[model samples]
Target chain A: MALSPDDVARLARLARIDLSQAELEHLAPQLDVILESVAEVSKVAADDVKPTSHAIEIANVFREDEVRPSFTAQQALSGAPVKESGRFRVPQILQEDE
Target chain B: MSGLVLQTAADLAGLIAAGEVSAHEVVAAHFERIAQVEPQVQAFLALDEERALAAADRVDAKLAAGEKLGPLAGVPLGLKDIFTYQGLPCTVGSRILEGWHPPYDATVVKRLLDADLIIVGKVNMDEFAMGSSTESSAYKVTHNPWNLDYIPGGSSGGSAAALAAFEVALSVGTDTGGSIRQPAAVNSLVGVKPTYGSNSRFGVVAMASSLDVPGPFGRTVLDAALLHEAISGYDPMDSTSLNLPIPPVAQAARSGEIKGYRIGVVKELGGEGYAPGVLQRFNESLALLESAGAEIAEISCPHFTYALGAYYLIMPSEVSSNLARFDAMRYGIRVGDDGKRSAEEVMNLTRGAGFGAEVKRRVIIGTYALSAGYYDAYYGSALKVRTLIQQDFDAAFAKVDVLVSPTSPTTAWKIGERLDDPLAMYKADLCTIPANLAGICAASIPVGLSSENGLPVGFQIMAPAMADDRLYRVGAALERGVADAFGGPVLNQLIGSPAWDALSAQAVAARFPNIILGLAENLS
Candidate 1:
């Protein structure tokens, strides 16, 4: 259950939050303690026990898709920091690698 | 009309029904109160005078037309910003979704509207309901009304503080771990977190979907129960919402009989690590309840010792999954990345810039928990722990009709005391976490003030799932006993009636310098 520095670094990368050197150093030990604390939960839980996912037992509640009046195209772009031609404009994705 | 701020929603309704006061007059009085105290308290995030007045007019119109209105007709309510409304922004206190208006009202909001409750405004919260203190709020930290320098327990701090400050009669707040109860404890307000699925979560901005529940906040136990009764019950739009009929919570509150009830004081909670003053007040509350003809005894639930640890795991893991939808493409705020950069890069830049430090910490921990090679070691095992905790409550409830504990381990601490230490912040939730882990109903009632600091302490009451009414009955009786001994609800005696002039311009200037300057400039 021990998490290495590399594992911590990988998690930071996966979560997309840029961590400082101090944060990486601090988190390594804190996360280790947290893992150790939670590891105890694994002991008493049986293989026969069903995992509780939701506080209440629930299931799929889907609605049929239908055309409905929505915020105007202009209104949708109102809050954006950058926009163009009724669509959200972002940094380009295509490159020579393709 | 003299103490309408302290009157329960039921009493207010009766007054309105008898023509003692018009809905318009009530709304206007509350608005004047908000104008006075809101500057120092920062209880509301958004307030539309037009909407509140319009809603009041509609209620007055109904009465004039000779039509009977619903139970909470014209009663003003403050909504936690996390709950979605049709036009109002529901940010979850995260900049990533800033200014994003929901397409429709959350099911709980819709239910409140159906009951004719007036929405006074939206309240501030911890960013995406991530922290135990309101200091983690991105916009501004909410201060405890008891001591202006101390923190109001959060992420429902604004809702609790609103009740304490008398800015609103009632509010709806969501609790994932101890958001509602902890704040209520610190602010000396009555707050309830009903059994999971008792209220619908259809359009609430998700934090940890499995753990999140919407509940009521009020100045009195019966007020909270009446609000809870109006907003709870089945909603076809919410799959997780219980179809079972809700018990009459207000009726239970009116019943003073607890002679046959057996209340178990959790042996695990009132132990070492609790502030001495907090424990003293809690025992006093127990004595008051005992004097009211209820039998009190000790009970043990060993699994509770590890509830906080398991809660951090399960909640953050769900948070990682739930917040994934807020990428730069589909949502509010987006940061650009180079053309060669992957989608992950764009997501990272957006999230890293948008989220606060605590939120980032949780996202990293959650992502690690759900990572490919670590799923079994983290998320999977945490779910198993949750089931065991639920079973522990189930077994404990078999021996006792209800359980009791101190709502919080300590009174509200000074603002910066634990801000630098996240572990200490997480530890504050120790006494409150078990109820959330067990999916049981819990309420926090202010029992007495601490001798050392003169701050309030709350006693926690818990009941098994779907036995929320039992909590109301016990809590109401306890509230009456404690209040009678203290001469009043303590909160009201000190804060006094809400007034437009007492919340001085100097206090407002000191607390919200920039906001006042902006308002003055706008006026000039």
Candidate 2:
């Protein structure tokens, strides 16, 4: 239940947020208390009870696949911080992860 | 004209429908009231005056043409910032989404438009609906109209405050964990969180998906119910929306009677930890319900004690997954791009820079909860707890028709009182969280005023899932009983008054040496 500083750091990395040392220090105890409090749920709830993700019982309700018109390439690129030859430019990855 | 601002949506609609008042006049009056009180309350993020008037004119044009308008025609309402409207910027109250306007209208918004309601504006909220108080709104803090120094409750605080300030007759708000009810409790408005799938969530900015419910806040229970009737139904767009008949909420509210009703007050709520004034009001309200031919008893849901813990875990887990979509590329608000870096790296940088502190905190917690080694320990276990809580409600509902409790553990606290401590803020929803966890419909109605600080107090009426009509029926009867017993609703009396007179007097004495008299207007 106790979250160590390393645990906090790992969580930050997983969440992709950069945290300052002071923030990490502050968050460690806060998260510890929160986790400790929530730990009680495990005590009351049994292993046999099925976990619920949605409050209501529902299943897939997908829309029919169809071609939909999109904004102009210029309009799409208008808000991008940077653009290149009508495409979005970004940092290189895997040298080509996608 | 002044009383028109205080009229319920039902009354306003009747007047508008009967040709006694033009829709345009009603809209204009509300616009005037907004101009008067909006400066003090900070309820709205966006108000399209021209659009509202044009819509009102159209409603009038229909009436003039002898066409039957809808029940809510010309009734001005506020939309929480989360619901996406075609041209309106849906910021979700975060700087990261400064001017992001979706190309589509949320299903609920479309439904409301079909219902002939005029949207006066978008209300402010806690950024991404993360915070318990509206202070987390990127725009500004929404002040409680009763006491400007106090919080109006959040993340639907702006909608509640708008209702409290008489700016809007009814407003739509999304409740994840008591967001709608808590704010309603603080501002003494009628707010209901329906069974999770009662309303469509297509355009709502995701908070904790499972718990997020779009509901109505109004000055009267009937108004709230009427609004609910307007918006509830199956939506094919949202897979989670229940394929069920929309209950007749408006009819239930009209015929709301508590004779022979079995109402059980939760043993966990209204205990030692509650402020004395809040407990007193709750007790008095319970007594009123009992006197009104209702049978009241104490019911214990042992597993209910762990609801907050389970909620925190479950909410963050979902939020972590839900917010992951805001990676700057697919939608609005992108941050830095080192240009040479990959799309994933740019997304990371954008989210890192765009999100506020509390949002980042939740995302981190959510990520931790859903992480590899911890998933079973946190999210899975928390979900198990949620199931147990649902069973608890199931068992309790078998013994009684519905549950009753103080809507919140405490009345509205001062703005800065619990902001420094997020846990303390989370604890404020203790009394209201059980219903959300159980996925039942819950309503909060003004019971009385907390004499300690003279702020509004609220009582919660909860019903089993899909029994949303019962919540309004019981709530309306309880509201009438409490108001009758108290001579008037507490919120009507507290508007524009200092919530904590002693605190105000002390500050005035310290700051103004010569001032010995209490100045209500000057205090705010």
How do all models score by TM-score?
Answer: 0.91, 0.92
Q: lDDT tens string, model 2, B389-497?
A: 8888998999899899999899999898987688899988998888887788999988878889878888899999888888888887878887787777666576445
List, residue by residue over B243-338, the lDDT tens digit for candidate 1. 788877888888856886899998889778999999998888888888988999899887787687778889889888888777777556666555
Residue pairs clashing in model 1 are none
List where candidate 2 sits over 4 angstroms from the true fold: A60-89, A94-98, B1-3, B495-524
Pick by DockQ: which candidate is best? Answer: 2
Worst 10 residues of 1 chain B by lDDT: B515-524
